[model samples]
Structures are given as structure tokens and as C-alpha cells.
Target chain A: MNSMKGKPMNHKKFEQMILTPEALTSEEREELARHIATCESCRKLSLQWQKASRMLNKPLPMAAPAPGFSARFAHSIEKRKEAEQQKQVRRFITILLVSLLSAALIFAVTYYSTNSLETIIKDTANASAQMLFLWESLKAIISTVTGFLPTVLLIPFLLTAASAMLTLTLLWLVSIWKLTLQKETVL
Target chain B: MEHELQQWLDEAMQGKEESFCRLVDHYQNGVYNLCYRMLGNRHEAEDAAQESFWRAYRNLHRYDPSRSFQTWLLSIASHYCIDQQRKRRMTLIAIDEPFEETFGSNSPTPEHVYSNNEQSSQMEELINTLKPTDRAALVLRYWHQMSEKEIADTLSLSVSAVKSRLFRARKELAEKMETRREEYELHERETYEPQKI
Candidate 1:
């Protein structure tokens, strides 16, 4: 237990010492041998440490990497390199296209912003109106599809409502998606 | 610095398949052995080792050359094992089959070698029951035979902390072994004793 409290030994040197297969220097080894002639506990601990140093002697089974692991690993690395190259090329192309598109967008918006705000609003309003009249559009669709029975007309209105809801939802989702894609302007 | 290694890394980074393959050729076994010791199985160890190398290749540019390359690579594999153990929430893996202790007899064969294996299995089972940290301490100290200072660096603990952890681990293992020995003794006594007539 005192070993627990004691500061770490010259453990850095111990690794080196083990590699040399001699526990101590010539003089130190002679002294240790002399001591071990009489000192029982030190002798035993020394033997134990010496035995532990023979770690590789026990010869833990380490198989060579399975046959053809090298070839397969090489193939996998090639695939990885190919994939990485593709990714880089795609990235460069994307960056190039994006820069071009961004330059075009910047030019268009800068030039057109003053005049286009009104036009943009008008376009949005038209889009929203189409959204707002979804029920009417769906009703037209339903009537076109199921046009015979008066009774069918009543049930057909329910179908129209569902269709209208789905269409509006989809339109709303698409608008959100498009908005996210657009770069934000501080102003 | 091996100029060859540098060339390989440079070419691989430039997306040369041949150079990258050469890199894999160089380090596969070392990675596999480290993983095998930490993971203690073939299939799982192979996967972790393979993943470690791939991760190393993927992040090759980020590698700092100031440190030992093998050490850096091992650090990656070490973290992978830690994350894996955390995910599984177990110190030892659960093989689909019952405990299969593969290896040869220490003593002469057919001299009830199964008994010796049972003893080793019992010890391993007790070790598995220990806290993961404690088990790591025991394994590094006794199994891998790393010095306390070496373990401190490997596990990123202070030397004193490594000592304390190892002491506790040995104490726990000893206690468990004692209990098992007592149980074995009692079982043997019951089985061998003739009923008083």
C-alpha cells in the first residue's frame, strides 16, 4: 500500500532497462546480486519484476491480418480516394456554380430591388391568392372527377376539402423550403 | 521522418489511390493488435481496428507530425473503443455463444485442462463485473504490463490516480477470487464427502 502513496518510480528508465534485459547497471547489478544473496523480499520482488518483463515470452497469439487484408484494404482505400476526389470535385463545382449564381443574384437583386420589391410583392400576392383559393381549385377538380350524383356532390365536397388542405399544406411547405434556401439580407 | 511515409501521405491527400493503399499496407497489423487487446475479440476488434485506420486516413491532414504517428493513430483507436463501450454499456462483450476460452493447456493435456480453463473463466467473469475503469487499470497493469506512468499517460490520468485505481482493482479482484475459492471449496466438500451411515 505504501507503493501506492510513493511517487512514480523512474518508470521511464524502467522501460529502457527492460529492453536491455539487465535490471541495473554493472555496479548496480553487482550490488543487487550481492544483496539478493541475503535479502529475501528484495530478491522475490526482483524475480517477479524480471518475470513480468518477459511479457512477450508468453507469446500472445496475434495472427497476421487475414490473408488478402492488404489487397482489400488497398482496394478500400482506393475507393475512399475516389470518393474523396469525387467529393472535392463536386465541392469545387458546387462552389463555382454557387459563386456564379450568387454573382448573378447579387447583380439582379441590386439592380432590380428598387423596382422589383413591388413586383415581388405582387408575385407573392398572386401565389398566396392561389393558395387562398385552394378550396375553389379543389372543388373544380372534384366536380370534374365525380360529376353525376347530387349525393356524390355532397361527399365530393369533403374530398375537395381534403384535397384543398393537402394542396395548401404542400404549398406552405414549399414556400418555407424556398425561403430557407434564400440567403438572408440584413436589411 | 520516413520520406516514404511523407510522400505517401502527400500523394494520398492529393487523391492518389496507390499511395493511400501503401499507407494501409504499412499500418494494418499494428492497428489490429492494439484493437485486439483492447477489445479482446476477433470480429469486433477487426471492425474497430479497420474503422480506426479509415478514420485516420480520413483525417490524415489534421494529424500533427510532432507526435509519434503510431501513438496518434492509437489514440484514435482508443477513443473508438471508449465510445463503443459507452454505447454498449458493458465492460466485456456478450458473445452469442457461452463463454468460449480458446487456447491451449498450460499443464499437460487431458490432465483435467477444463478445470484450469474454468478457473481462468471465473477470474475473467469477476474482472468483467468490475467497474470499467478498474478493469482498464487491471488490464493495463497486469495484462498489457504497462508501467503505472505509461498507463497514466495512456489513460490521461495522474500517476497517483493510476496507482490508486490499480490498487483498488487488485483488491477487488482478490476479494472476488477469495469468494469463488470458498464457494469452490464448499462445493467440492459436499460432492466428495460420503453420507454418514
Candidate 2:
């Protein structure tokens, strides 16, 4: 059926309106009623929707779990808690073993690579001298940098810069940790 | 009652097992109903409901207090059932097969057959034919009386998507029900033809 404006009433639009007639504007509903009054197909669809809507309104039978459901659920919760605890213990043990093995591997590689105690002592002395030279260079560089700025201003600036750098570093590390954890979960 | 549930939720969050159990006792039926409707079977529904609860318990910290807890639980159940349905479709089961299969060749008893035929309404049977997401949308919309926005939130779809799917689901269901009604009438006439003679 065509509306008074001569446009055919689309079945799809009418079906949608039948499903949710309350959504229709009053004018659209009046037009729909006029069309349904004349259109046999749309009227049949409208009745079918009414029956379907009634079917939807009927009470659905509620299904309950078998007896002992709550008890079984509580038991499952307990089992989960135990499993999580066991997992934590296993993780701690694994971490401890890994740390000890890593320390042993480092010690073995260091002791075997160095020739003897005398060589080890010589290497330690050379390392200490290098550190002392590095400290002297750092002191010289600091004196040079202080030439243009007051010590008070320089200290606060360095502290602020250090804090900002630390914060950025922490944030980067956190992001990487989160990314890796996410990857593990996805895998 | 909602405030009571919120109080129980708070206690459960505090590691009180009894409070959690009370919450379970209260919402178990709702969760089970959603699962059974989505899965169309009892055993799978039970497993899915249990799994949903387990997941919810483990991820309780992620539950936002501002939203409805029932919706959160139903979302988990719907997602699990939808995933299972996807896996089930991957295996390619025939549409005409009985809802459940036992190991033996024994046929279903007469009582089982009758009850099975009677329990599934034409609407629900037609609904079972829909895609998992669409089925979830219709169930949440009609059975649960959820608004379109809530259905969208639960199904992780947009509101317009939910509206469109609901419209499509109802249309499809109406078409299927009409076909079934005609088939039933034809069968009745065929059975009555011999008696008429």
C-alpha cells in the first residue's frame, strides 16, 4: 500500500515497526495503521509479530543446577586457592634455584677464566687505578662545568634532571615489563 | 536487594568465602539460565556456568563497581558460550542431529523424545538457529529485558549493531516460525487424510 504521499510502504520498515511499534512516531504509526488496514501482506506480518511478541513474553522455565551445587562450588573455590598457593610456592622455589644457579655459573666462569690469585689481584689493582683515574676526570669535568653557574643552581638542576631521567627510566621499564607479560598471556 | 548484593560483593572482595558463596547462591540461576539458553544443552551449560564463575572470581579485581555485576557475569558467560559455539561450528556438526549424543547406539526413550519436542518452543528453536552473537543479543534483549545499550555493552558491540542484530534476529525468527507452522499444518492434514477416507 502506498502512503498518501504515494510512496510504497516498505515491508522491511513495517516489520521493524511491528517489532518495536513503540519506537514509531505518532504520525508514522498512524500511517502504518493506514497501510496495514489496506495491505494484506503487511497485516499478516503484523499479526505474526504480535504472536512472536507474545511468545517472547511467556515465562521461560528456569533451570537450576543439581543439588550440592553450592557445596561443589565452594569446594572448587577451595581447590583453586590451594592450587594457587602451590603455584606460588613452586614459583618461589624456581626463582631461588635460578638465582643460585646463575650465581654459581658466574663464579665458575670468573674463577676458571682467571689464571691464578696473583693475576686476580693484579687485575683488581688495575681496575682500582682505572676507577681512580675516572673519578679524577669526573672532578675535572665538574669544575669546568661549574665555572659558568652557581653551585646552588647547578645542584638543583642536576637533581631535577636526575629525577626526571629516573622517572622516565622507570616508566620505560614498566612498559616493557607490561608488554612482555601481555605477550606471555597471549601466547 | 541490589544494595545487599553490593554488600556481599564488598565482603567477598575482602576474601570472605562465605560472602562469595552467598552471591553464588543468589545469582546461580540467572547465570545458569543464560548459559543453558546460549549453549542449548544442560551439561555444557553447567560447565560454562562454572567456568564463568571461576573466571569472575579470579578476575574480580577487574570488575568495575560502577557497572551492574550481573551484566559483568553474563558477559563472561556469553563470551565463553560464544567461543564454544565457534569451536563447535568449526567441527561441522549436522543441523538435524539430536541435541545430545551418548556413546551407545541406544535410541532415545519415548519420554525423552516427547519432552525434548515439547520443551523447546518455536521461538527458542528458531533462536537456536541464529549466530552466537545474534543469539546473545536477542536473549539479552528479550529474556533478560536488557536495553539495547546494555546488550551492546554485554556483547561488546555498538548500540546500533545491537539494534540491527535484534531486528534481523526477530525477522529471521518470524520467518522460521512461519515455515514451521506451515509444515506442522501440512503434516496434520497428511495424517488426517487417511482417517477422512
Error of 1 at B172 (Å): 2.7
lDDT of 2 at A31: 82
Where model 2 places Cα greater than 4 Å from the true spot, the runs are: A1-9, A38-41, A81-187, B90-120, B185-197
Give the C-alpha interface root-mean-square deviation per candidate.
7.1, 5.8
- lDDT string for model 2 (A1-187, tens) is 4443576657777778877786999999998898788877778778777767767765545556766666778889978877886686677557655755665465446444634567557656775786688669767866787788786588555545445544554454455445545654676
Give the residue spans of candidate 1 off by over 4 A.
Answer: A1-59, A63-65, A78-121, A125-187, B1-26, B95-124, B133-145, B180-197
How do all models score by TM-score? Answer: 0.48, 0.63
Q: How high is the lDDT of residue B170 in model 2? A: 76
lDDT of 1 by residue, B9-124 (tens): 77977867678767777777666655655555677767887778788878878877675566667667766876776787876554333333334445446454566445544555
RMSDs, each prediction?
14.0, 16.0
Q: Enumerate the chain B TM-scores of all models.
A: 0.62, 0.80
User: Candidate 2 residues B1-197, lDDT tens each?
Assistant: 88899999998878787888888888888788788778877778788988898888888888898888999999999999999999888322223433432223554687965554443445556778888898989888876889999998898899999989988887777666678778867887998989999
Q: What would you estimate as the lDDT of candidate 2?
A: 0.74
